[model samples]
Target: MQLLPDSWPPARRWVQVALINLVVAALLGALMRYIFLWEVPGVEYRNIMHAHSHGAMLGWVYLVLFTGYVLLAGPARRVYTYLFWATQLTVVAIFVLFALQGYSASSIAATSLHVLLSYVAVALLWPDLRRRLAGTVALPYLLAGLGSIVLSTLGLWALGIIMSSKPPNMTLFYLAIQFFLHGQLNGWFMFGTLGLVVAYFEKQQLPLNRPRLRQAFILLLCSLLPTYGLAVAWAERHPAIYAVTALGVLLQLLGVVQWLRAVWPALQQLTARLAPLLRGLWAFGIGSLAFKALVHAAVAVPYVAVMSFTVRNFVIGFVHLVTLGATTLTLLALLHGQGLLSLRGRVARLGAWLLLAGFVLTEMLLFLQGLMLWLDWSFIPSYHTVLLLATLLLPAGALLLALRAARAPASTDPGAQPLPQYAAHSPVSANGSADTAANR
Candidate 1:
């Protein structure tokens, strides 16, 4: 029996590798949480954190986005395949080096190499993107996301300069780090993922309010530039900066509304037909995006902004809200929708739900802790112990997902088929429900 169907997306290996990285990252995260509750000798919290964050960002999220690009690029390019492996190697180097030595020269070099690799990818892929995506709705979003990827490197460069400064400007260093994080989370991850989603719609011949989508894109792009202020507001404590960030937040709110308008119709028609598990994934992903926007709006309030930056719990919660809640869920849903990872099995469903539950439970605890601290309320009893227990679910779930993908069988679903072959499958029916018989 073939382990994978011949028709599977060319990015199949990429997805498999990415899932393994996700598991590694989740394990690291759980380990960190565990350290908070008990003495784990030889494990430095900061080092583990560096490893976890880098692994999650580059190993899992970045690779998945790269998979999306490959899926959209039509035919496989040798360069893309080379870049994927090269990036994977670099990600492994960074994760291991950081875990062992926490931001030494070697790890920094590896990190820089990853940045350089991305720049090279943009250069190599630009022509194809321009040619293939020119007339599509995904064009602007993908291009903008790529641009953001490049733009974020400026922060890293600044960080290098600051760290090498005579007195080592800690303030500038922190700001630079925040700038990079904001760019990746809000700019590249959000836009790139949405680009992939919109590209799927176009490919499926789904009905979309094109004009509204364009409008939303413009607003979101414009807003994304200034919202860096929100990341820096507490450190700078400037009224003018806060004012600008507030405007950006408001624009983002409006953009989300317009975005919902643009996609809601198609989503309404498609979601009802989605498999139950996939539908739950979609709801969690989409709901997280809306919730993220609302949270940003709240941070526009100076008090809330300051509190968010100061409270460690709030910071962790917000980061996870975007990374795990929005990006990861959406990617998984898209993966399932594409039929790359079948959700029909009990093992798959259990893994997905466990991951979702872990995210929800941890996020609630984090935000609640933040709130209690802000209001001078009592801390949750045995918070660290409870959090560690919840955190364990993430890795457990991730392991199952990786195993499921590893054992996935070949199929003819759109996800399993090459881009050109998708037209051969009549997936949707007259009533807007997916033709389960045909798809399955």
Candidate 2:
């Protein structure tokens, strides 16, 4: 098989880097667990956790997805190969430097590199993304979500620099975290999910116009209300601002309901073969809605007893469930679209079932743990271990799915052709490349 492409050289590199980082992160996690089991004291768990988070989120998840998009989405004027490689290099440097030197001068240098590379990547991809939105009803919402990513990245970069400085201001760090959280949770994850759903439904010739418009409105409201309320609450430190934020939270919950209503008709028509993946996405949406509601309830109560467990559930249980579970499922679906995976076969079906089970169990355990903590109940170390072990199923399932995809034959659609064995031989136009290769 042809190996390299003149225009997509970075695509392969990106995948390789992402996989390496994932492996490293997993190894680090294992090491940490072993050390903890050995009763190591002053083990600097927090720093290791930071490394793991950075590696997994930025290095593995984002990089791999972006790389896949580059390879599968085909050539666009904006997305040159060099820029992609530079961005991955910057991300890898950030993780390595952070681990070696802690959050200091090296971290600042690495963060600066990442910021610069991120800007370049965004600039390069903006034109193609804008083209994709040309006549879509949800164009404005899509643009707004893109804007959120830009704003969030800037905030994240600022946070990184601040974190690297000596005698860091804890309050500023907290504010930075808040900004980072909002940007990722609201701007990137939420918008990305909605955009993907709309895109997929439209491609499938399913009814998406109404739901797209409705979701756009809800997301717009969600973007504005909570942002304003959170700013006011932070500035004033008043209970009233909290209440207003809670109102915004309720609005978000309403948006979720509207989303479900919009998609329910299409979901109802899914074949038995597609049910598992569809159900996984549905679970994610439900979890997202529940999380939003819980946030509102927590804000209203504001008492430690009532708020703590709810807050943890929203953050760790709900947020993570939707994020890790839904996002992965969506990514897998997208990959399938690219002809990277087949939804048919015993292995594929078993993998899907295992993944769904793992996600549900892990999320449930996480919520249970949060409740235990809130109630000051006795810790169940064994239960925690089981949860961690259960999480392995997700990756295991993913690996199996990947193997299936790798073994599947290329699409035989009349309009489609097999992907060029070499990147250099691939068609330059997105339509020619994608539609000629896969229906997705």
Candidate 3:
């Protein structure tokens, strides 16, 4: 049996980090429920929510994407391993301190350390990316995503420092949240996921002309416009700015429509082989567009408080649907392409179905929650319980799928790669030279 290489240690380390964060998020969620629903005291629901959100969003989801990106970009070997360990240590220290002693000066110190280390990890990728840019259509998008990460981290660090020195101001808190949300949603998740799609299509040898590439870039920028305006409006408290932001959001919706049109033909071809998974991706994209429309409407009519609900569902619901669901599924499909998942068994198909079911069910719960809030109805206690239960099951199915993939033999095919356009060159021989330029 060929052992997993020590040179690729960072990817494995990231997987471990993701698992740890998943556990931590779950524990924090349970603790919050016990405190609020079971009458335990001294455990702030908001704080627990903060912890859960950070662990899941930054720790699990983003880390997973980071790992996949690293793997696809070629292993970093030593440098990334060091950065990964340092970042993980910082993250764990901060979270542990927060969970045990509550928020404090020391916790803030840890947060600062964590932020610095994370920025370092993100920065380390710059050299690697610089090396990989030749003939890659997705390179620009990935670079832009990384740039956003830097800005987001800086914003977060600034907010943390400010909060440490002053009393809580609602406006500052609101601005901070907006900054963090935009950074994650538009900057990291959308940019990263779409970059990967570009990479995948490239690897599959799908044609990408200059015009299509330009459209993709425009889509990304359009997506960020409303978010940028919203940030400005929140910080400056300008009604006109808010109106303009709503207009920007409408443009973003139009951009998404254009994007879907451009990709429709390619997606149709992929449908025969990737039916269920592609369907999930479509659902996620459609849901996200719906969310953008709702948010625009909510902004247009200030009387409606449903914007929060709409935004939350968009972030939590559709974002995860694409990030955790579609992206992860596509990664698995890539792994399977590399013979990391046995394609010969019914077990793999079963695992896929289970995962798909989990995703659909979870999205249904989110949709129901949004509908309730939109209609000005109170959600029942059971609804929250069901939501949690569904969340738990979804990851459980994902874990099973991952394990099955991990147990399979690695592909020996010289040409087995992610997608055609993503493959920079033909597979390298033992001498690190191109072996053959075979198509997928």
* Candidate 1 lDDT over residue span 159-190, tens digit each: 89998879998888988998889889999898
Error of 1 at 409 (Å): 5.5
lDDT scores in order: 0.81, 0.55, 0.57
Backbone N/Cα/C clashes per model: 4, 1, 10
TM-score of each: 0.92, 0.76, 0.78
* Two-way TM-score contest, 1 vs 3, winner: 1
Best by TM-score: 1
| Top of the candidates by lDDT | 1
**lDDT by residue for model 3 (138-170), tens:** 777777777777776666765776676657676
Better of 1 and 2 by lDDT: 1
Quality of model 1 by C-alpha lDDT: 0.81
Model 2 error, position 172 (Å): 1.5
Model 2 steric clash pairs? 417-436
lDDT, residue 233, model 2 = 56
